[model samples]
Target: MLVLFLLGTSSSALAKGQKHTYWHLTSDAGEEAGKEFESQLRSVLVQAEGTHHTTEGSLAELLDQKPLKVPSCFEGAKLCTTVPELLVEALGVDGLVEGRISAAADGYQVELTLYREFGGTPKVVTRSGADLEGVVRDAVGALFTLEAAIKIYTEPAGASVFVNGNLVGESPTRVQVHEGNHGLRLEKEGYEVLREDLTVLPGEVREYNATLVPKVTQITVITWAESAAVYVDGKLSGASGAPIDVMPGAHSLELRANGYRPIEITFDIAAAQRRTIQLAMLKEVEDPWARREQAIRTYRLYVEAGYALTLQSIGFAGATADIAGSTYSPTSFGGEDRASLVFNGVKLAVGYTMERLGLVFLGVDLMVASMDSELILTAQDTARRESAVGQGASHIALYPLQGTFRELWGAFGAEAQTGLGVSFDSLNGDLTGDAFDLSQTAVFWSLAASGRYYLSEEWSLTLGYRMDYDFADQRGLRHGFFAGVGFNLPLLVDAGGESKDESLPEQLEEDVPVEGTDVPESTLQKLEQSGTEGGREP
Candidate 1:
């Protein structure tokens, strides 16, 4: 903190022999926080009427970039640098000031010090709040955050509260406590419940914002009067006197009243989601009706099934891993070396998309390949074994291993997709034909840009460009254009049933002429059925 002020030795104070002043100050720049010493002194001497005893000092980091407000995202730790003692001596003043910061509740504070000229005891200054600007008006934790403290609040207020697994407070005079993250819960009898993660910084006041998510329930033993106890994820959310508001996502809810058959349902909650569930109290069925209803639910799900579609692509490639050994064969692959090895195509796909959070999606990939190659191996002292096998002859071995690293290996991020969703993509792949199939395949990877325009719900137009190493027949960059029809596979989604989208062929039925005339039906059949034959409209 840097303040420009002017002060003079008070004659009345001097006469009374009480002239030691307690002063506080503030600075606008983070790097020059210590610059306050000289700045304040200069302001007092040049800007104010000061004459008796004067002191000036600086803070720790004189040239560090200010810490960004984005918390841990953009830190200012790098901007901090130390100044030499000579420079501090050059601006000889009464004292130097220094301090460090730690979070409290809603804000942060710093413990400052006033250094003496003779290296005497330092003056300790403590600011206690988020609003503390300086010691002049003044009066002041390295905390690594962990579990965050979530705030809990009622729309109106005065709701009973609970924290971590226990009952804590009631609304209105709700106690705001702790500086850090924590599990929180808030509830009210007969109201929806709230529970969430909370992260509060030291010296910061946090809110555990809980709102009731309404749900249409089937807890009624009887139509309009029965009240079921609402449990969120197997725990009591408020006493379910009415539909309670709960945050959306996956949750297990049980509605049990004494006389009513206990009913439990699981569902996913979304943001700002409002659900009105009417508990349809059902009468105790004999046997057949209950079985019939269960059967209907299962049958209906089968009828509403959607279609399946697959995206396809084809490619030819080759490559060579050149060994730097003295006695090794330098082989090449691609269009130059014509052989039985051909890469029909490679495909990656995801299927069975539902309205869920990618729960139903299953990713798959296929590679169509046939290749033959001979490798020079040092088996005998003077003679090398040339192992040549037929194309598509090698058996593929499957080894699936999952490994976790302390650091992240891959990530998807883009500045353009910060808020809105439109973005760009790139990908590459490389393969070695045999040992050295350079003439056929060289590029191990390729990059492609694709733009899609959906003209209608049933169809879309796609355009793409790829800049890649020539692996097919060792060709440089072979550009290609493609246009294809996109249709839903309604048959695939059905349980091996006839596709509704495909109608019966009309050409299957044929007309025959009678022997005596050109009529389509016989005289006997004409009496039994309609005699005239149908003709195409011209």
Candidate 2:
């Protein structure tokens, strides 16, 4: 026998102990056959357990001899739709069970229908078998099978519900589960999974409500620098070295700190996950004063060695020159007896430039020179005598306004200097055979104009002319021209640290450290000072 049960309504009505009246079981085989099947089925129902069975005879008696009319639809049809309504109105039964039997090729096919008093669509159980009584027995047993009704609700209404590891449906839904122990699981995205063990009894309508917790991901950022701002998805979250909470997914993170390179990253996180990101930020150079201090060469040490040519003259006031024991009054004594001297000397200077004020330098200068000259004395008798003289001077030169010209061809400058010096003059080898020597030390003041050309940051070439007038003992005038190669040693001021080539704005914008890193303390202090000073200025 092949018996199949199809339930059209919830099986809760079929639970044990329900009251139902047994209606007629019709058949097309014959009236005698129908009567025999109905009698056997009624006998079986009366013996059944867990239910109250009322027969058609008892229902008619309850109505006081009223004639019972079976609906015409049950005569040969597969279903009887009007039976539950009639039974409920006449006998006031809770439910009604009706069936129809038809001849099949094998033997017989039976369709059993159950309807509740509320007039819903009926439940049908079908069976086909050669043994008519056995089919009726099996159909009755199938009709009243036990099941538990489960109503599942979740905080998020659309979570998938699984019963005994099988997907049932989404909650807030109702499902008919077979009576027993079962594992129930609910799952939703971004929420924790919920699982519980359930033991349901027959006819139990169990309501389950689950409040699911959300899945959170924690991100810890460990930066090499302090006070780094941490940003997630373009919104500022907090400082680095702190934990940030976020939903699990792809995100953009940015780390920014003063004086350090900014860093950006894109990453994905998993649910209930902990992630740590360790970052080292690069340094940035953003202080303009520091850069200017480095770029400005503040100290200059100069050593110059040069060759000089000088003209020395002594004026005569009513003076007479003795030539070969003869006395003569000479009119142009200063012009005719002028001595030209060549000297080799060196000049050394130490200077400090006020770069912030505008490339002006204040310095002390020293010049030392040794000069030897041949003085020629001539007479009207066509006699010429020569005397050799030696001269030396040590002078200190000072410039009131000395500065570099930046816009000219490659580093050039001009300065005017006035200085005082002691000049030593010696005359030896007189025109006569007798040797004579005369020495004089005199104080002299000099005026000079010099031009300098820089060969590099620390080297130069200088050329100048100077005039000197002696003021004590021997009143004499000297004019000199000099040419020299200069070596300039620069003493650069410390701008807190080594200078960088990046511009200040660029460094401030992009070059900074991310995490646990640090800029030099000296550099940072200088930068802050520079900023403070700049703010104070116009």
Best by TM-score: 2
Model 2 C-alpha lDDT per residue in residues 66-138, reported as the tens digit of each score: 3566455433322234345665554455666667788888887888787767777878999878987777767
Clash counts for the predictions, in order: 62, 13
Error of 2 at 86 (Å): 27
Maximum-lDDT candidate: 2
Candidate 2 steric clashes: 13
Stretches > 4 Å off in candidate 2:
1-188, 191-216, 223-227, 231-236, 246-248, 252-265, 280-350, 354-362, 376-396, 405-538
Model 1 alpha-carbon miss at residue 337, Å: 99
Residues 212-302 of candidate 1: C-alpha lDDT, one tens digit per residue: 6443332211122145576778887654445466754677766665433455666665545555443332222223333222222121111
Question: When superposed on Cα atoms, how far off is each prediction in RMSD?
Answer: 35.5, 19.4
Clashes of 1: 62
